[model samples]
Target chain A: MLKKVLIANRGEIALRINRACRELGIATVAIFSEPDRPSMWVKQADQAFCVGPGPVARSYLNIPNIISTALITGADAVHPGYGFLAENARFAEICADHGLTFIGPQPRVIAAMGDKATAKRVMKEAGVPITPGTDILENAEAAAAAAKKLGYPVLLKATAGGGGKGMREVRAPEALEAAFVTAQAEAEANFKDGRMYMEKLIERPRHIEVQILGDSFGNVVHLGERDCSVQKPSHQKLIEESPAPALSDRIRKSLHTMAVRACQAVGYVNAGTLEFLVSGNDVYFMEMNTRIQVEHPVTEMVYGIDLIKEQIRIASGESLGYAQNDLKPAGHAIECRINAENAENNFAPAAGTLTGVVFPGGPGIRVDTYVSTGTAIPPFYDSMLAKIVAFAATRDAAIARMERALRETSIEGVNTTVGVCLEILADKRFRAGSYAIDFLPQLMRAGVS
Target chain B: MRALASLEGLEGRVRALAAAFVQSGLVRLRLSRGADDAIEFRRRASSAAPRVPEAAVFSANGAPERLYDVIHADLVGIARFSRPAPAAGLALESDRELASVEALGIRTPVRSLGPGRIVSVLFDDGAPVEYGQPLFEIDRE
Candidate 1:
C-alpha cells in the first residue's frame, strides 16, 4: 500500500482523493493556491502547502512546484484528481523520474490517448467502432474537402481538444471555411496546437460512456456505463446517470466489451472512461479520458467501489483482487453537478462568499462539496460548488430521490443551478429517459427553464 | 520615569509619523512638544531603497526606527546558502544573494531586494522548504 500521497488538485475532488487515502491508512498532503487557503480540503489533509498565487497556471498547474512539494513533503505518490495536470504526460514522466508513483497510467499511454484523433485511431485499430473522420487537415480547403465527403453536417474538432473547447459544428459547405479558421484559432489558444480534424456529426445522439479500471498486471474490468446526454449549450455535462437508461442491452454490453478491449490493446492501467455517441443501436467511439472524471461518483454509487482507492492500489503494484465476473453492479445512480452559475443568465459563472449552505442527506443520498458557510468562491477556477448524487433500486426512484435531495439543498450568497436542475428533473422527456444531448440547450432556447 | 511619562499616548502619534516618513521621500522630520520633549527622525543613506512589503515595525532607540521584513522562499525545495548562513545582525547589501532553493538540481536564487540587517534565520542550512515559507527575517536599514 502507498504510504503518503500529495493531492495535486483543489476543491471537492482533492477532498475526495484525501478521503480515499485516509480510508486506506495513507497520509495526504494538499496543495492549494493562495485564494484557497481556507478550503475544507486543505484543513482535512495531513499537511497543506500554498504552491502559488490565485491563477491556475501559477498554482494548480505549476508542475515544477507540485513535484518539488511532493518530494519535500516525503510523499510516496501523487494523486492528480481530475483537472489541471491530471492528464499531462510530461508531469507523469517527471513524477516517475523523481521516484514517485503517478497513480495513473503510464506516460506513453496518456500521450497516446491525449490526442483525440490518435485515440480514435487506436480504438478503431482495436476493432472498436469509431466515427468516420479525417486526420489533421492541412488547411481550410482540406477541411472543406473532408466535410464535403463526410456529409453536410460535420464537426471540426481540435486534435488536442476536449470538453468542446476547440469544436465547431458545420452544417453546410459554405460555412466550412469560417468554421475551420475559428476552430483552428481556438485550438491554438486552448491547447497550443492548431491541428484540426473533421468528423461526421451524429445528430442528437445519447452520450453514453463506460467506466473501466485496469491493474498493471493486465487485469481490466468494466463498471458499466453512464448516460451524460444532459448538457448545457457549451457542451458541459450537468447531469449523469448509470445503466444509461433506455440503452439496448446489446449495445451496452458491446460498449463495455469494447472499452476493455481498447484498454487492453493500449496496455492501459488505472481508472479511465471511454465516451461513445449512441444513435439508435449504433455506437461510435468519441474519446478516452485518461484520468478520473468529474461524474465518477455515479459509477461509484452503483458499483460500490472506491475508484480512487483502486487507482492508488493499482499504482502501488497490487492485483485487482477481483475479476470481471466478481463485479455485480446494483441499483441505479444519478448525479447533478451544482455549479456556482446563473442558469437563467446563460449559465454565467458566479463568484461570492457562501454565507449559507445546506446539503441534503439520507440513505442512498451523498453530497460532495468543499464549500460551507463563510467559504469564498473564487473566480479563478471551475465554478462547481457541489455534486449531489442519489442512488435507488431503479432509475425512476433515483430521479425522484435526486429531485427531493435538490429541493432540500440550499446555497446562498451566489447564484446556483439548483433551480435549473429541479426543472430538468421535472421535464417530461428527462423523466422518460429519451432526452438527447441537445435537450437542455433546446429547453433553454425555448425559455422553459 | 520622566521619559516614560512624557511618551504616554504619544506612541500612536509616533507610529503614524514613522509610517508617513517611510512612505514619503522626505529626508528628515523634527518635532518638539514644549521645550523638553524634542523628537528627531532621520532617514538612513539607503532609506531611499524601495519600501519593503509586509515589514513589521518595532521600536528601537525609544522610537519606531526598525522594520523587519520576512523573506519567503519562492520555490519548494532544499534551501542552500553559498556561504555560511548569515547570523542575526549581519548586514545585507541590496540585490545580494541570500540563498538558493534547489529542486531537481535546478537552483533558484533568493536575493535581498533592499539593504537590511538580518534579524534572524528561520531555516537551517539544507532544510526543505515549501513555497512562501519564511527563510529569514531582515531588519531594513
Candidate 2:
C-alpha cells in the first residue's frame, strides 16, 4: 500500500479524494496554486505545497511542479482528481518513470482511449455498437462526401476532444462544409490536433453511461448506469440520475454487459466510464472517459461504493472487493451542478466575492462544495461552484429531494444556475426521463420564444 | 474634550481601520480604551445662526479635516466615511445633517456568490458606513 498520496488537482474532487484517503488511513498531500493557498483541500490535506501561480497551465497543469511536490512530500502515488493531467498519458508515464504509481489506467490505455478515433476502432473490434460514421476526413470535400454517404444530420467530432468541445451538428448537406471547417478550426485551437471525424447524429437520444471498475487482475464489473441527458452547450451537467429510468431491464442488462466487455477488451483498470447514446432500445457507444467523471457522485450514492477509495485500493495492487454478482444499485440518486453562471445572461461566468453561503441538508441531500462566505471565485477556472446530489428509494423521491435542496441553496455574491437547475428538475419532460441531448437547448429556445 | 484631542492622534490608526473596513467590506472597530472619554457625536445643522455643529468644531480647529470612523453593522463591516462636515473654506455653513449611521435592514440580506469558507472576520463589532460600500471578503474554497 502507498504510504502517502499526492492529489494532483484541486476543488471538490480533491476534497472528495481526500475524504476517501482519510477513511482508508492514507496520508494525503495537496498541491495548489497561489490563489488556492487557502482552499479547503489545502487545509484538509496532511501536507500542502505551493505549485505555482494561478493559471492552470502554470499550476494544476504544471506536471513538473506536481511531480516534485509528490517526491518531496514522500508521496508514493499520485491521484489526479479528474481533469487537468488526469487523462494525459505523458503525465502518467512520467509518474511511472519517476517510480511513483499513478492511480489510474495505464499510460498505454490512456493513449489509446484518449484518441477518439482509436478508441472507436477498438470498441468496434470488440463488438461494441458504434454510430455509422466515417474516419477522419482530409478536407471539406471529403467531409461533404462522407456526410452525403451517412445521410443528413451528422455530427462533426474532434478526434482528440471531450467535454463537448470541437463538436457540431450539421442538419443538412449544405451546412456540412462550413461546419467541417469550423469544427476543424476549433479542434485545432483547443486540442492542437486538427483531425476531425464524422458520426451519424442520433436524434432524440438519451445520454446514459455505465460506471465500470476493474483491477489489474482482470476482474471487471459495471456499477450501474447514470442518466446525464440534462446538459447545456456550456457543458454543465444540470442533472444526473442512476439506473437510467427510461431503459428496460433487458437494455440495462445489455448495457452492463457491454460496459464490462469494453473494459475487459481494453485491459482497463482502476475507475472509468463508458458513455453511450441510447435511442429507444438501441444503444451506441459515444466514448470512454479514461478517468473519474464529474457525475461519479450519483453512481456512488446509488451503488453504495466509495469510488475514489476503490481507485486507491486498485492502484495499491488489490483486487476488487466484490464480484459482478455482488453489485446492485440500492436507490435512485440525482446530482445537480450548481455553477457560477447567470442563466438570464446566456450562462455567462459570474465572478465576485461570495458574501453568504447556506447549503441545504436533510436525509437525502449531499452537498459537495469548496466554498464559504467571503470566498472569491476566480475567473480562471470552471464555473461550477458546488454539486448538490440527492438520493432516495425511488426516482420521484429523488427528484423531489433534489428540488428541495436546490431551492434551499443560497449564494449571494454571484449569479448561479440554481434557478435553471430548478426549472429543469420541474420540467415535465425531464421528470418523465423522456428528454434528449437537445432538451436544454430546446427549453432555452422556448424561453426565448 | 481633551480625550477627543488625543483621538486626533488616532489619525493613522483611523486610516488603517478605514482601509481594512473597505477591504473587508464589513468591519467593526470598537472604542476600546477611551469609550467614556471619546464622545461619539454625529454632526447636526446649526439653527438659523449659520453656526457649525459641535462635531464640526474638530475640523474648524485645523486638526486635519480627514477624521473618519470604521463603521460596523452587527459585527459585519459596512462602509467607511470621512467625517462629513461642511466643506472647508465655505462662505455659508448650511444647517444640514452632517452624516447618518443606521443599522442594516434585515430584508436586504447579504449572501455569498459561491461555496467558500470564511477565512477571517475583519470586524468583531458591526461596521458603520455612509451609503455605498462593500461588506466583507469571502475566501473561495
Candidate 3:
C-alpha cells in the first residue's frame, strides 16, 4: 500500500480523500492555496503546505508547484480530486517521472481518452459501439463532406470539447461551413486545439453512464450504470441515480460488459466512467471520464464499495480483491448536487459567509461538505456547496428520501439550489424517472416563458 | 485568542494578534479570560470577514490608515526581522522587498504585492517568530 498521499484539491472532495487515506493507514499531505490555508480541509489532513495564492492558474492548477510540494512533503502518491489537474495527463507523467504514484489511470490512457475524437476512435477500435462520427476534419470543406456522409443535423464538434463549448449544430448544408469555422475558432479559443470532428447528433437521448474499475494485472469490472439524465442543457448534472431506472436487464448487462471491455482494451487502471447516450435500446459511447466522478457516491451507495480506496489499492499494484461476479448493485441511490447558486435568479453564483448549515442526517443519508457557520464562500472557485445523497430499497423510496432530505436541509446566508432540487423532485417527469438532460433547463424556460 | 494578551505568561501576544488582525482582516476575536474580564479585538472593511462590523473610531478613509502585514511561512525556527521599522507614512514600491524573515541562516524575502507606505513594523529584528506567523505592516500607497 502507498505510505502517503498528497491530495491536490480543495473542498469536500479533499476531505473525502483524507478520510479514505486515514482508514487505509496512509498518511495524507494537503496542498492548499492562500485562501485555502484557513479552510477546514487543510486542518483535516495530516499535514498541509501552501502552494500559491487563491487564483487557480497560479495555485490549484500549478503543476510545478504541486509537484514541488509533493516532493517537499515526501508524498508517495498524489490524488487529484475530480477537478483541476485530475484529467491532466502531463501532470500524471510528471508524477511518474518524479517517482510519485499518480492514483489514477496511466498517462497514455489519459491522453488517449482526454480528446473526444481520439477517444471515439479508440473505443470504436476496441469494438465498443460508438455514434457515427468523423475523425479530425482538416477544414470547413472537410466538415461539409463529413456532414453529407453522416446526414443532416450533424454536430460540428471540437476534438477537445467538454462543457458544451467548441461545438455547433449544423442542420443544413449551407450552415455547415459557417458552423465549422465558428466551432473551429471556438475550439482554438477554448482548448487551444482547433481540431474539429462531426458526430451525428442524437436527440433527447437519456444520459446514462457506467462505472468501471481496473487493477494492474488486467482485472476489470463494472459497477452498473447511473442515470444522469436530470441535468441542465449545458450538461451540468443536478441529480444522478444508480441502477438507472426503467433500464431493461439486458441493456444494463450489455452496458456493464461494454464498459469493462472498453476500459480493458485501453489498459485502463484505477477507477473510470464510460458515458453513453441511450435512445431506446441503442447505447452509443459518448466519452470516458478518466477520473473518479462527482456522482461516485451514488454508485458507491448501491455497490457498497469504496472507490477511492480501491483506486489507491489498484495504484499500489494490488488486485481488486473482488471479481466481476462478486460485485452487485444492492438497491437504489440518488444524489443531488447542492450548489451556491440562486435557482430563482437564473442560477447566478452567490457567495457569502454561510451563516448556518443544517444537514439532513438519517439512515442511508450522506452529505459531503466543508462548510459551517462563518465559512467564507470564495468567489474564485466553483459554486458547489454540497452533495446530498440518499439510498433506499427501491428507486421510489430513494427519491422520496432524497426529497425529504433536501427539504430538511438548509444553508442560510447564500442562495442555494436546495429549493431547486426540491422542485425537480416534485416534478412529475422526474418522479416517474422519464426525464432527459433537457429537464432542468426546460423547467427554467417554462417558468420564464 | 486575543485574551491571551492579558496573561503575564503570554507576553507580546497582543502585538502578534494585532498584526494578524490587521493583515487577515479577522474581526471580532473574543477570547474570555474568566472572572468577567474578556479581551475583544474588532476590525472592519475586509470583504472576506464582511459580517463583522467596524469598531468605533474607524472609518473607510481615516487619518490613521491601516498597515499591511508580511506573513511568515509555516516553517520552524528562530525568525529574525531583517529591516528597521520604517517611519510611519513612508511610501514603498509594490515590488519592493520590505523585509526578510531569516531562520537558520536561510532567508525568505517578504515582498509586497501592492505598493504601500510603511506605517510601522510590529516585530523587532531579533524576535523569535513561530511558524505560520505574519510579520510587518504597510499602508497602501
Candidate 4:
C-alpha cells in the first residue's frame, strides 16, 4: 500500500480524502493556498504547505509547487480530490515522472475520456448504447446536415465543454446556424477549443450514473447507479441518490454491465463513473468522469465501500480480491449538496467567515465538510459548503432522513441553499421520485413552495 | 575587566551581546571598564527586533526613516546557498544570487529584489522551504 499521500485540492473533498488516508494509516501532506491556511483539512493533515496565493491558477493549479511539495515532504502518492488537477492528464504525468503515484486513471485514459465527442465514439465502438450524435463537426453546413438527420431540437455541444458552457439547445431550423456560431465562439473562449458535436437532445431525461471500480489486474465491479436528475439551472447537481428510484431492474442491470464493459474496453483502472441520460426505456450514454466524483458518497453509503482507500490500493498495485458476485449493495442513500450561494438570487456565491456552524448527526447521517465556526469562505473557489447524506432501508425513508438532516443543519454568516433543499424535499414530484433534470429549475422558476 | 583585544577571542560572547543589544532596541551600546577594556555595538536606524511593521517609516522632516524588502521563496524545495548566506549588514546588489531551491533536480534561484543591506537571513542553508516562505529581510533605507 502507498505510505503517504498528498491531497492536491481544498475544501470538503480535501477533508474527505484526508479522512480516508488517516483510516488507512497513511500519512497525509496537504497543499493549500495562502487564504486557506486556517482550513480544517490543513490542520488535520500530518503536514501542510502553502502552495500559492488566493487565485487558483497560482495556487491549486500550480503544478510545480504541488509536485515540489510532494517531493520535499516524501509523499509517495498524490490524491487530486475531485477538482483542480483531478482530471488533468498532464498533472498525472508529472506526478509519475516525479516517482509519485497519481491516485487516478492513467493519463491516456483521462485525456481520452475528457473529450465528450471522443468518449461517445469510444463507448459506441465498445457496444455501449449512445445517443445519435455526429462527431466533431467541421463547419456550419455539416452541423445543419447532422441536425436535420437527428431531427429538430438537437443539442450543440462542445467537444471539450462542461458546466453548461458552450452548450445550446436549438429547437428549430432557423436557430441552428446562430446557435452553432455562438456555441463555437463560446467553446473557444472557455476551453480554448472550438470543436463542436451534435446530438439528438434527450428531453426531460433522468441523469443516472453508474459507479465502477477497476483494478490494474483487470478486475472490475459496478457499485450501483446514482440518480442525479435534481440539478440547478446551470446543470450542477444538487441532490443525488443511489439505486436510482423507480428504475427498472433490467435497465439498472444493463447500466451496470455496460459500465464494466466500457471499462474493460478502455483497460481503465481506478474508480470511474459512467453517466447516462435515461428517457423512458431508452438509456443513452452521456459521458464518463475519469476521477472520483462529488456524488461518490451516495454510492459509498449504499455499497458500504471506501472508494478513496480503494483508489490508493489500486494505484499501489494491489489486486482487488473480490469478484462482482461477492458484492451485494443494500439500503438507499441520498446526498444533498449544501452550497454557499443565494438560491433565490440566481445562486450568487456568498463569501464570508462562517459562524454558528451546526452539522446534523445521529442515525444514518454523514456530513462531509471542512467548515466550522470562524472558517473564512474565500471568494476564489467554488461555493460548496458541505455534502449532507442520509442512508436508510428504502428510498422514501432515505428522503425523509435527508429532510430531517437538512433541517438540523444551520450555517450562519453566509447565504446557503438549506432552505431551497428543504423545499425540494417537500415537493410532491420529488417525493414521488419521478423528477427529471428540469425539476429543480422549474421549481426555482415557480418560486419554491 | 576585559580588554577589547581579549574579547576578539570570545566570538560567542560577542554574538550574545549583539542579541542583547537588538533585544534592548537601543541605537548603540558601549561598555568600558577601563581605557583599554572597551567594547561597542551600533545598530542602524531599522536594525532593532520586531521590525517596525515592514512598512516604510518617515521621519519628522519627511525623509524616509527606513524601507525594508522581504524576499520569499517562490517554490518548494531544499534551499541551498551557492556561497555563504548573506550575513547581517552585508550590502548586496538587486540581482545578486542568495540561494537556490532544488527540487526534482531543478534549481530555482532566489535573488535579491533590490540593492539593500541585509538586515537578517531567516532560513539556514539546506533548510526545506515551502512556497512563499520568508527567506531574507533587506533594509533599503
Candidate 5:
C-alpha cells in the first residue's frame, strides 16, 4: 500500500482526490503554487509543498519541482489531478524513474494517446469508428488534396492536441489553404509539432465521451457516457450530463463496448476517457484523454464509485475491486462548470477576491470546489472556479435540480458564467437534449438577454 | 470610531473611489473648516496612490516634513521603520515569493525588510502602491 500520495495538480480536482485519499486511509501531500497556498486543497492535505512561482511553467508544470517535492515529502505515489502534467508522458516517466508510482496509465499509454493521430489510428485498428482523414500532411498541396478527399467543411487538427487549440474549419476549397497554414502554424507554436491532419467535420454533432477504468490485468469497463456538447470556443464546458439524454440504449451499449475494446487494445490501466463525436446514430472516436476528466463527478454521483480511489488502487498493483456486472448507472446527473469569466466579454477571465460564496446543498446536489468566501481567484490558472453537479431519478428532475442549484449559487467579486449557465439550462434546445457542439456559441452570438 | 459597515458597503465605497480614480487618474483635495465651520476641499495631487498608500506618518497630518526628507535621502532606510514593513519569518510555502515592491505600482523605493524571493508580479509599471498588503514573498533560501 502506498503510504503517501502527492497531488500534482490543483483546484477542485486536487480537492476531489484528497477526499478520496482521506477516505482510503491514505496520506496526501499537496503541491501548490504561491497564489494557491491559501486554497482549500492546500489546507485539506496532510502536508503541502510549494513547487514554484505562480506561472504554470514555473510552478504546476515544473515537473522536476513536483517530483522533488514528492521525494522530499516521502510520498510514494503522485496523482496528477487532470491538466498540467496529468497527461504529460515525461512527467509519468520521471515519476516511475524516481520509484514513485504515477496514479494513471503507464508512460507509453500516455504517449500513445497524447498524440491525436496515433490514438485515432490505434482506436481505428480496434474497430472504433474514426473520422476519415489523411496522415500528417506534408505541405499545403497535400493538405488541400486531403481536404478535397475528406470533403468540404473538413477540420484541420493538430496531430498533437486537444482543447480546441490548433483547430480550424474550412468550408470550401477557397478557405482550405489559409485554414491549413494557420492551423499548422498554431500547431507548431502550441505543440511544437507542425504536423496537421484533415478530418471530416461532423456537422452539428454532439460531443459524447465514455468513461473507462481498467487495471494492469486487462480488465476494462465503461462507467457510462457524458454529453458535453454545450461548450464555448474557449473550450470551457458549460454543461455535462451522464447517460447522454438522447442516446438510445443500443447506441450507448455500442459506445461502451467500443470504449472498452479501445482500452483493452491499448492495454490501458487506470482512469481514462474515450471522447467521440456523435451525429444521429453514427459515433466516431475523436480522442482519448489519459487522465481523470474535469467532469468525472457526474459519473461518480450516478455510479456510486470513487474513481480517484480506483486510480490509486490500480496504481498500487490492485486488480479492479468490482466486476463489470456490478457497475450500473443509478441516477441521472448533470454538471455545470461555473467559471470565473465574463461570457459577454468573449469569455475573458475575471480575477478578484471572492467576497461571497453560496453553494447549494441538499439531497443529490454535489459541488466540487476549492473556493471559499474571501478566496482570491488568481488569474494565472484556468478560470473554472467550481463545478455544480446534481442528481435525480430522471433527466428532467436532474435538470430542474441543476437549475435550482445554479439559482442558489453565487460568487461575488469576479464576473462568472453563472448567468450564462442559467440561460443554457432554460434554453429549449438544451432542455430537450437537441443542442449540438455549436449550441452555446450560437446562443451567445444571438445574445441571450 | 464610526459604526462598522458591511463588506458590501465598503466595497461600494472602494468601487466608487476606484472608478473615480481610474477616470481622472489622480485627484488632489484638502479638507478644511470653512468660515461657516463646514468642511471645504481642494484638489492637490493629479493621481491617487495606485493602491491606498501606506500611512507613512501616523500624525493627524500626512507624513511630517522630517520623515519626508529622510525618505528622500536614504530610501533603503524606509524598510526599517516603514509603518507597514513586510511580514517577516512567516512559514510560507515554497512557491510563494516576496511581493515585488516595484510591481505594487508604488513610486517609492522599497527595501527588503530582511530577505525574500519575488513571487508574483502584481503590477508591471511603477504606479502608486497600497501599504501593509502583500508586495511579494521571501522564503528562507
Candidate 6:
C-alpha cells in the first residue's frame, strides 16, 4: 500500500483524493498554485507545498516541481487527479523513474490510449465496434480522399487532441480542404501534433460510457454505463446519469461486454472509462479515456464504489476483490457539473471570488467541492467549481432529488450554471428522458444563453 | 487572563497578531478591550524561517518599503542557511548577502532584499523549501 500519496492536481479533485486517502489510513500531500493558497484542500492535507505561481504550466503542470515535492516529502505514490497531468504518460513514467508509484495504469498503457487514432485501431483489432474512420491521415490530401469515401458531413479530428479542439465538422465535400488545414493547424498549435483522422459523423448521438476497473492480476469488471448526452457548445458535459436512461437491455449488455473486452485487450490496469457514441441503437467506440472522468461520481453513486481507493489498491498490485457478479447498478444516480460560468452569456468562463455559497445537503446528496465562501475562482484553470450529485431508487426519483437539490442550492457573487441546470430539469424533453446531445444547445437557443 | 477556548482559536490569534505587527519582532495582542485575554507570539529562530507572507504582514507596515524574497522559488534543491546576521539584524540600510544555498544541480545566493537584517533563521542548512517559503528575515536593517 502507498504510505503517503501526493496529489498532483488541485480543487475538488484534490479534495476527492485526500478524502479517499484519509479513509485508507494513508497520508496525503497537497501541491497548490499561488491562487489556490487559501483552498480548503491545502489546509486539509497532511502536508502542503506551493509548487509554483498561478499559471498551470508553471504550477500544476510542472512535472519536475511536483516530483521534487513528492521526493522531498517521502511520498511513495502520486495521484494525478483527473485533470492537469492525470493522463500524461510522461508524467507517469517520471514518477516511476523517481521510485514513486503512480496511482493509475502503467506508463505504456497511458501512452497507448492517449493517441485517439491508435486507440481506435487497437479497439478495432480487439473486435470492438469502432466508428467508421480511417487510420492516421498522412496529410490533408489523405483526409480529402478519406472524406470522399466516408461521404459528406464527415468529421476531421486530431488524433492527439481532445475537448473539441482540433475538431472540425465539414458539412460538404468542398469545405473539406479548408477544414482539414484548419484542424491540422489547430492541432499543431495545441498538441504539436498535426496527424489527423477522418470519421463518419454520428449525428445526434447519445454520449454513453462504460466504467471498468482492472487489477494487475489481469482482472477486469464492468460497472455499467453513464449517460452524458447533455453538453454545451464546447463539448463540455453539464449533466450525467447512471444506467443510461431509456437504453435498451440489448444495447446495455453489448456496451458492457465491449468495454470489458476493450480493457482486457489492452491489458489495462486500474480504473478507466471507455467512451462510446450511440446513435439510434448502434454504438461505436469514440475514444478511451484512460483517466478517471469528471462524471465518475454518477457511477460511484450507482455502484457504491470508492473509485479513488480502488485505483490505489489496484496500483499496489492487488487483484480486484469483486467479480462481475458482485457488481450491478442499483437504482439511479445523476450529477450536475456546477461551473464558474455565466449561463446567461455563451457559457463564458466567469472568474471571481465567491462571496457567498450554500451547498445543498440531504439524504442521497453528495457534493465534491474545494471552494467555500470567499474563495477566489482563478481564471488560469478549469471553471468547474463543484460536482453536485443525487441518488434514489429510480431514475425519476434521482432526477427529482437532483432537481430539489439544485433548487435549494444558492451561490452568490459569481454567476453559476444553477439557472441553466434548473431549466434543463424543468424542460419536458429532459424530464421525459428523450433528450439527446443537442439538448443543451437547444436550451441555449431558447433558455439562458 | 481569560483562557482560550480552543488551541485553534489561540493559534489563529497568535498568527493574526504576527501579521498585525511587522515592525515589532514580537507580537502581543488582546482578544477584546473589555477582556484581558492576551497572548504573545514566539519565533523559532533557525536558518530558514517559515515566512509569514510579506503581503499579509507588511500591508500594515505603513512604510512603503518593498519586501524582497531572499530565495527565488524556481530554484529546486535543498536550502542551507548561512551564518547568523552580524548586527542584531535590524534596520539594514542596503541589501547584503546572507547565505549561500547550494544544491547538487544549482547554486544560489540568499541576499537581504533591502534595509533589513536577519531577525531570525527559520531552518538550518539541511532544510528544504517549497515555493515561496521564507528562509531568513531582515528586520529594520
Identify the candidate with maximal DockQ. Answer: 1
- Give the winner by DockQ: 1 or 6: 1
The interface root-mean-square deviations, each candidate in sequence, come to 5.3, 21.8, 7.5, 5.3, 14.1, 5.3
**Model 6 ranges with Cα > 4 A deviation:** A136-144, A158-166, A174-196, B1-77, B82-119, B138-141
lDDT of 1 by residue, A43-87 (tens): 999998888867898889998999988988899999998989999
Candidate 5, residues A1-449, lDDT tens digits: the string is 77899998999999999998999999998888766777899999998876665678877887766776676567899999888999989989988888899999989999999877678789989999998888878998998888777788898888786677789988989888888888888888889988887888888999999999999888998999899998897656778999798788999899999999999999999999999999998889988999999999999989998888889999999999778899977889999999899999889999888877999999789999999898977778999989999999998999899989888987899999889989998989988888889898899899978
Each model's fnat? 0.50, 0.00, 0.00, 0.58, 0.00, 0.32
Candidate 6 chain A lowest-lDDT run of ten:
A440-449
DockQ score of the complex predicted as candidate 1: 0.29
For model 2, the stretches where C-alpha displacement exceeds 4 angstroms are: A138-141, A157-168, A173-196, B1-141
lDDT of 3 by residue, A130-170 (tens): 99887779888888788888998888778788877898988
Compute each candidate's TM-score over C-alphas: 0.87, 0.75, 0.80, 0.87, 0.76, 0.84
Candidate 1 off by > 4 Å: A136-148, A158-168, A172-196, B1-53, B58-62, B93-95
Query: Worst lDDT window (10 residues) for model 4 chain A?
Result: A112-121
Off by over 4 Å in 5: A138-144, A158-167, A174-195, B1-141
- Give the Å shift of residue A442 in candidate 1: 1.0
Q: For candidate 1, lDDT tens digit of each residue in B1-141?
A: 888876675677777877776556466566765544555555444333212233434343445445467788877889987575677888877658888999877998888778888888889889888767788888876
With a 3 Å backbone cut-off (N, CA, C), the pairs that clash in candidate 3 are: B68-B138, B116-B141
lDDT of each: 0.88, 0.76, 0.80, 0.88, 0.77, 0.82
The candidate, 2 or 6, that scores higher on DockQ is: 6
Better of 2 and 5 by TM-score: 5
Error at A24, model 4, angstroms:
1.3
In the range B1-141, model 3's lDDT, one tens digit per residue, is 556544544445655655566556666566554445444556443334222123322222224423344434444233354355444566776556655654434667766557777655556665544334455555543
For every model shown, the clashing-pair count is 0, 39, 2, 0, 16, 18
